[model samples]
Target: MMLANVGTADRIIRIIIGLAIIAWSISAENLWWILGAVVLATGVFKFCGLYKVLGISTQGSTSK
Candidate 1:
């Protein structure tokens, strides 16, 4: 399975960031919700583009 670890801290941070973005969108009427959307998307995919660029995989073995 390619879907591996994605530790607890990262998961929580992603969720918090996404919620914050969405919240900011409502309160500040900014486009920061896109950040939230990205966070949510990353959580769903269990993959981060930045992480890949940095050659990092917290999700255990990326090789399926």
Candidate 2:
């Protein structure tokens, strides 16, 4: 698959955020699974709904 540049950045950011959330959740007795789901969805789809709704596109239409 010719994954877009946005995809890469999205995946990386999602994972980082997910890890942070999970860490905080673990320390605060919260749900880590929520963050896991967000990370999974973003990583699998390579598209972030929040990013889309905000009209943010990190990559060109074509993957380089």
Candidate 3:
């Protein structure tokens, strides 16, 4: 199963930041676009491999 480690607010912020990075990358025609794409993807999917590696999850638990 794909665990959703990103919360709604975090995802929204990521998407905004990612889009800004992408816009800058496009204007500069640099490799930063790749980073932006990855951020956007992680936001969209609500899963972050880095978060997994770091044992960090923004999602609230439902263990009740």
Candidate No. with top TM-score: 3
- Best-fitting candidate, measured by lDDT? 3
As for TM-score, the candidate ahead, 1 or 3, is 3
Residue-level lDDT tens digits of model 1 in 1-64: 3443455578778878888788989799888888889997777667777877677777664443
Q: Is candidate 2 or candidate 3 better by TM-score?
A: 3
Whole-model lDDT, candidate 3?
A: 0.93
Q: Residue 4 of model 3: what lDDT?
A: 95
lDDT of 2 by residue, 1-64 (tens): 4333356766777777777777788788878868677876676567666666678777657734
Where model 3 places Cα greater than 4 Å from the true spot, the runs are none
Model 1 residue 57 lDDT score: 72
**Which residue pairs collide, candidate 3?**
none
Higher-ranked by lDDT: 2 or 3: 3
Which model is ahead, 1 or 2, in terms of TM-score? 1
lDDT scores of the candidates, listed in order: 0.74, 0.69, 0.93
Residue pairs in clash, model 2? none
Which regions of candidate 1 are displaced past 4 Å?
Answer: 1-5, 61-64
Order of quality (TM-score): 3, 1, 2
